[model samples]
Target chain A: MKAKKSGGNSLFSVTAILLILLVWQIVCSAGLVSPYLLPSPVDVVKAFISDLPLLIQNARITLIEAFVGLGLGIVIGFVFAMMMDRFEPLYKAFYPLIVLTQTIPTVAIAPLLVLWFGYEMTPKVLLIILATFFPIAVSMLDGFRSADRDTIRLLESMGASGWQIFRHVKFPGALPQFFASLRISVSYAIVTAVVAEWLGGFGGLGVYMTRVRKSFSFDKMFAVIFLISALSLLLMKLVEVIQKACMPWTKTQ
Target chain B: MADLSIRDVSFSYGETQILKDVSLHLKDQELVSLLGESGGGKTTLFHVIAGVLRPDRGQVLLNGQDITGESGHVSYMLQKDLLLPYRTIIDNVCLPLLLAGMKKKEARAKAAPNFADFGLAGTELQYPHQLSGGMRQRAALLRTYMFSLSREGSPVAALLDEPFSALDTLTRQEMHRWYLGMMEKIRLSTLFITHDIDEAILLSDRICLLTGRPGTISEEIVIERPKSKRDGFAVTEEFLEYKKRILKGLKRT
Candidate 1:
C-alpha cells in the first residue's frame, strides 16, 4: 500500500503544491497579513520569471565553485590515502589533523579566507574544498586499510611487488568508497560554496541574495531561495546516478 | 626438497601463547589439515606460516630456503571471501596477476581460463554482490589461487583457515569436494584448518590437533590412505574410526 501511494503521489505531487498556493492566495486576500510582508505566490512567480536569466548566471558561478572543489577534493583524498597506506607514521600524524579540519566550521573559517585572499573565487573555492575533503579522505582511508589481506598474501607469494599489491588489491577495493565520498562531498561542496559566497564574495547567488534583501525584494528573494533548493536537489540526484553507473554492485544496497 | 617445513614454531600475543612448539613437514602435492575446536591456534598457525604474524621462535622453510619472516612465500585464505565489491568478478580473480605488474587487460585475460573451471563462466561481468554465496566463494578462491600462484614467485604453500566454514552445510561439502578434485590437476602443499573433525579427516593427509584457551598443538595424526585411493564417498572405515579418536582427543585437551 505504501508503494502504491508513493507511486501515485509522485505523479500528482505538483497538484498538491498548486492547492497550497490557492489556499495561500485566499489567506492573503482575507487580509490576515500585510502585502509588503507576505506577497502572493503569483508575485513570487512573476519575480522568478523576470529574474530567470540572471539567476542562471549566478547559479553557474556557484556550481563552478562547488564542482571544482568537489573534484579537487576527490583527487587529493585518493592520493592522500595512497600515501597514508604506504606510511603508517604519516597516516597517524596527519589523520588527526584532517579530523581537526572538519571540527572547525567552514563558516567560521570563510571570513578568514576572505581576509587572506580577498573577495575573489579563491576563498569560496577553498571553503568548499575544506568542507568536502574530510569525508572523502576518511572514507577512502578506511577502504584502503581494510583491503583484502588474503589477496595481498596471495600476491606476495606469487612474487608480486608492493606496488602491485596496492594497485590490484587496495585500489580496486577503495573505488566504491571513493565514489560514495564523492557524492557526499558534492552536496557538502554546494553548501560550503553558498556560505562562502554569503560572507565575502560577489556575483554568485549568495551575493544576489544579499542584493535582493537590501532592495527589499521579498518575492525575488523567495524565487532565489527556490532556485538554490532546486539546484542542490538536482546535483544530489546526479551524484546518485553517477554512483549507479560507476559501481552497479552498490545498487543492491 | 619438500614444499614446506616448520620447526619448533612458537608465537604469542603479548602474555598469551598462541602456537606452542608446533612443527610440521609437508611434501609437494600433499593436502594436510589442522583440526581443532574453534578459537584453537589453527588460524594463528596459518597466520604465522603466512608471515602475517611473527612467531616468537620458529623456522619456516619453503623449497629448501628459509621463509621465516618472509612476507611473500605462502598464500593465505581466510574465512571471509573478501571480494572487492566495487570490481567485477573477473577483476577480482585477476588480482594477484595485476599485483605482479601485469597490465589490467592482461591480468584479466590470464584469468579467463579458470572462470569456466569452477562453474563461473558467464558471471565475470557481475560484481561480487550479484553472485550467489557459493559463487562468490568460488570467485574468491579463484582470485586467491590466481593471485598466489600465477605470479612470477609462485606460493609454495596454501594456508586455508576455515575457508569453507562460513558456507551452508551442503555448500561447504560441495566446495570441499571441488577443492579436492582440483588438487589432482595443480598440486601444492596445503595446510587447512577447520573446526569439523570430519572435514579435517576428509581433506588432509595429516592433521594437527590444537587445544584452545591459550591454544597449543596437542596432537598430530597422519591420515594413512594412499593418494590413489582417496574419494568423496565418505565410506572409508579408517576415516570413521579416527574421527572418534580425534573428538575424544579434543575433549581431553
Candidate 2:
C-alpha cells in the first residue's frame, strides 16, 4: 500500500523536475539572459560530463566529510539530549544555550571555525556537526519527553531500572523523531560540508566550485550546483530508506 | 502467587486532594475492579499501587512486603495499549523478561509459548501497528503479565487502568469475554479500574465502588457466580442486581 503511494509521489516529482528544466531551457534559448550567465541544461550536462573525473574526486572528499560529520553529529546530539532528559538541572542549563547556538548564523561562524581548525577536514566536519546536531538533539529531546507516560509507569511496575526504562522505552520511543531529524540533518550535513569548504578547503566540491567561479566558467558552476542538489537529494533518499528498514512497523498502519 | 493490599491510602496533587482514605485488597486468583467516575482518582490510585506515585498517607503491600514509593512490584496496563511502535509483537511481549535480566534468546523463547493463549499466534513477527485494537490490547496485557510474572519469578498482581476503554463497543464486549478466559488461564491477582459498571460486572469477581470529590471505596459488590458458570452472565439478573447496587453506591457519593 505504501509502495504504491511512494511510487506515485516519485512520478509526480519527476514530472515537476522535468517541467522546471524545460522552462529553464526555454528561458536560456529565448536569450532572456546571456548564455554565459545562464547556461542551458545541455550546456550544464556537457560541462558535467567533461569535468566528471574532477567532480567525482571533489564529491568524494565532500561526501566523506558529510558522512563523518553526520555520524558525529548524531552521537553528540543524542548524548546531549540524553543528559538533558536524565537531569532536570542540566536541561534547564543547556536547553537555552542549545537554542542559542542556532541563532548565530552558521555562515558567520564558518570563517572562525576555519581559522581555529585550519584549512583541513576538521573545520568542515566540525561545522557540519554544529549545523546538523541542533535539530536532531531538540527533536530527540521532545520525543523522549513525549514518550507515553503509561508505558513508563508500566515498565516501572515491572521493576525496570533507569537504564532499562531508557533502553526499553525512551530510546525506542525517540526513534521516529530521530529519523525525522535525520532527514533534515542528512541534507544539512552536505550543505554545511560545502559551506565549510567554501571558507577554506584543500579539495572538495565547494573548492572546485570556487575555482570554477574564479575562472568565469558559468557552465561548470551550474554543473556543480546541480551536483550539490543531486547529492543532497540522494542523501535524503538514503535516510528515508534506512528509516523504512529500521521502522518496518510504521509502514503497516 | 501473592495478594495485594492498598491500606488507607490518601493522595493529593498540591492542594487538591484526589483520594481520601482509599483502601482495597486483591485476593489471590481474584479479579477485582475499582469502578469510578472519570477524574475520580482511579488512575492516581493505580499509580500509587503500581509504585509510580507515593501516597500522602498509607502503604501498598505486595504479599507481606511494604512497597510504598517503589516501582516494579505490580504489572500495569493503561487505557492505550502503549506498545512500542517499532518492535514486532514478539519483541514487544519479550520486553518485561528482557528487563528482568533474562538473556534475549531466553526471553524470546519464554514469551513464545503464550502467544497462542493470548490469541496472537499468527502475529508474532508483525508490528503493533499491523494489529487491530483488540489484538494490541491482548499483546499489552500479555506483556503486562510477563512483566509481573518475571519480576520475582512468581505470579504478581496486575493493575489495569481501563485497558479496554479504547475499543469499539462490539470489540470491547468481545475483549471482555477473551479477557475473562485469559485471566483464568494466567491467574494473576488483578485490579481493574473502569468507569463502565457493565464491564466491571462482566469481568470482576468483586467490584469496589470509588466516587465523588475525594475518591474512596464506598462499597464492594461481590459476584457470586463461579468461573465455570460465568458464560453469558452479563445479561443475567444477578449481574443487573450487582450493577444496580453499584449505581446506588456511586449515586451516594
Q: State the TM-score of the second chain for every model.
A: 0.91, 0.97
**For the second chain of model 1, what is the TM-score against the true structure's chain B?**
0.91
B96-150 per-residue lDDT for model 2 (tens digits): 8888889989988988999999999999999888899999999999998788667
TM-score of structure candidate 1: 0.86
Model 2's A-chain: what TM-score? 0.95
True contacts kept of each: 0.64, 1.00
Best model per lDDT:
2
Model 1 iRMSD vs. native: 3.3
* Top-scoring candidate (TM-score): 2
True contacts kept of 1: 0.64
Which pairs of residues collide in model 1? Answer: A158-B153, B96-B147
